[model samples]
Target: MSKIQFKAMVVTEINDKQFSREIVSRDVSTLPVGDILINVKYSSLNYKDALSSSGNKGVTKKYPHTPGIDAAGIVVESKNENFYPGDEVLVTGYDLGMNTSGGYGQYIQVPAAWVVKLPCNLSLKETMIYGTAGFTAALSIYKLIKGGVKPADGNILVTGATGGVGSVAVGLLHKLGYAVIAATGKPDAKEKLLKIGAKDIVLRNELDDKSGRMLLKENYAGVIDTVGGNILATAIKSTKYGGIVTCCGNVASPELLTSVYPFILRGITLYGIDSVMCPMDLRIKIWSLLANEWKLHDLEQNVEEVSLEGLNTKINLILQGKLMGRTIVNLDL
Candidate 1:
């Protein structure tokens, strides 16, 4: 198998501050040593992929690397007893993309612990559709439900609602009977957000609070914040008493500048979401939920399919915050 060749997108450094991305041929022998070798059928674009492809050293520490954080495919070879050739599998969020060759390539070899058997009723393409973004959304919703925030309690605010995580969260929440209030910086995304189950749309700018007041009018019973910074701060201040809020990303700004008045006065609960390094049992459980009850049958309504060659265009769009919904990369195409 050392002579077998596969196509992959590789990012190379031109200088300290510059880099280049291009399609290139790589050999199976070049793959990292691991227990499983997969023929990746599909991958997806995320904000982190954009940063890695564009020489964001913070996301990727090395040059000439692949940057897909999500992968869904069939196993081609395995040394672990739990896996065998021809078995379906998926991988996400455990150093597969960062500092390691990722799903942007047609193949990947990873540790057995990082691989998950494809759940019942979910196709490889469908799993890539959910990807890390959707998985994170699922984790956030899990927190909200487990924390006692019920759909019948009140509205659920999804900040950055037009992005991958927010859009999936909107659809899943709507399917679960929650009244979703979508917030986005993009004005034209209102229709798409509504089509996917948002009950109302609020401009992202509207969620930002310039007032010096410690707290504001109570509206939402729960909040799923994907973008950090003022939007998160504002959501905390506006949450209803005994409400729950789950935070996942810091793309807007990592620094959260807010006081504890919301917690102290209203007794609100703020939960942080971390999909990376999630426990194996919980990871399997979450994926099972996504495959079954949480599955969005209309996920295609918000999906955009692209080939490996087309991924570059999406990387640019995501970096500029222009990409909408989910964009999955098709290796077979």
Candidate 2:
């Protein structure tokens, strides 16, 4: 085919400390060289994408960049034999949406190794709905299971419950028969959380222990913590003996201030989740599980679809911790 032109969300630096996003037409030739070129059908807004869009150098060192970490689409051209034109695929993590031009565009050129065939029972749109957040949630649950935390162990506490990762974690854990306790700052979300399979809801402040005590009442068998800092430390401290806690994000704060009493005395295990560089084998396994047994029946209830023009608002809301659930971007719109 001749040169392909498509629309994309571009973030450009305006001044010494200012930035702006605009939807502009881009040619496929402008995309970075890769073995596979995909006609992106759907993309998703993520915390990293927001940071990149706002000129967070830590997330994106350069400007005039696209900020979408999660994408699902069909392969349009491939130098790698593993992919062919019209092959449906999805990509997340790696350097995507970070230093690399990511999924915010109508097209993305990525290494074939970064792509995975869309699993049966999942459509491109549905896959984007899961996005990186849902994938991280699944990875957290996988670690918890590998660490021997079972449904019978006790209640699993999910912090940042209304947020993307936390909501998906709650739903997945509950679907697997685990009792889930969702903690969120929004009290009005109680009914929503309960409907999504949370056995109960606790105000986020309840987990932010202020007491200097090295430990608190041991309650949770496993904790899926999407927020960091005091909340993570509190979860570590409050975990029952031999419990496991998987931490994925540091939205609250990157710092973890706590003693080793939780680790040694309580035999608690803390697993740091890194979905970006997850091995291909594990990634495929997780996606397969997500498409199959762990699929959320109420996915639509937790998902909102938006066009590229509407992404900026959602990005700002996510940075402020005001957005809940997932937002998928439809390139066609």
Candidate 3:
């Protein structure tokens, strides 16, 4: 067969004043050097993808680049004998959608080290449905559980509960039989959070409007925090004795300002969750759990499928905190 070309979303810098993204056609030869080439079926829209699309230099250092942190599909070409054509796989993080052109295309040439064989119980669409965001949530909950969190250990708190990470955390925590307290700035999301398994809804203002008294009344057993900042600090201070808090994002701000009172007095454990460079062994374990034990009750309820062309609007929606649940980008469509 002759060379097959595919469409990709490419970002271009327009002078110093503007940047633009457009669909461009290119052959597989244009991809960055790698051992495996994939025929992408699905990719998901993440906050980082939105940042890269809108010219966030920290997430994406270059223009004329494709941005997608998570992708699932079938192997079309492989130099490594470990993988052959037609084998299913998925790739997330580890410089993907960063300096490297990522899965916002019909094809992706990626380092074999960054790829994972799709678990047998999950399909291409189902894998992307969990995506990087869901994986991070799973990792967070895993750490909390490993640190001794349990269903009867009071209620678990999920901050930014309407976003992808928090939404998955709430669902998973609830599935594990924990009372979940969801926190969100949008009051309109209360009903949505409840449907997703939050037993209680705490307004953002109610949590962040504290007096910074070094510590507060013991409130939660554990917390899944995506919007780091005061919310994280507040949650830490309010956690019960021996409680764990897993923080994974800086959507609000990166700076963490809190005293050692919670740690010293309550023996609280603060865990930092990173999905990008997670160890392969742990990543496999988490993926297994996501596919089996920790599976959500309504995995498809919060999903909103969008085409590649629809990304421009959804990107803005995610950045504005107007979107809830997961937004899976249907690259094949």
**Candidate 3, position 303, lDDT:** 96
- List the global CA lDDT of all models: 0.94, 0.93, 0.90
Where model 2 places Cα greater than 4 Å from the true spot, the runs are none
With a 3 Å backbone cut-off (N, CA, C), the pairs that clash in candidate 3 are: 11-64
Candidate 2: 10-residue stretch with minimal lDDT:
1-10
lDDT of 1 at 266: 94
Write the residue-wise lDDT of candidate 3 on 240-316 in tens digits: 99999999999988989999899999999999999999988888889888877776647889999988888888888
Model 2, 4-108: lDDT tens digits are 999999999999699999999999899998999999999998898899999999999988899899999999999999899999999999998898889999999
Instruction: Indicate the residue-level lDDT of 90 in model 2.
Output: 99
Q: Which tens-of-lDDT digit does each residue in 1-333 have in candidate 1?
A: 446799999999999999999999999899889999999999999898899999999889988898899999999989999999999999999998888899999999999999999999999999999999999999999999999999889999999999999999999999999999999999998888999999999998898898977898999999999999999999999999999999999879998888989999999999999887989899999999999999999879889999989988898888888989999999988
Residue 85 displacement in candidate 2 (angstroms): 0.4
lDDT of 3 at 96: 87
* TM-scores of the models, in the order given: 0.99, 0.99, 0.98
* Weakest 10 consecutive residues of candidate 1 by summed lDDT: 1-10
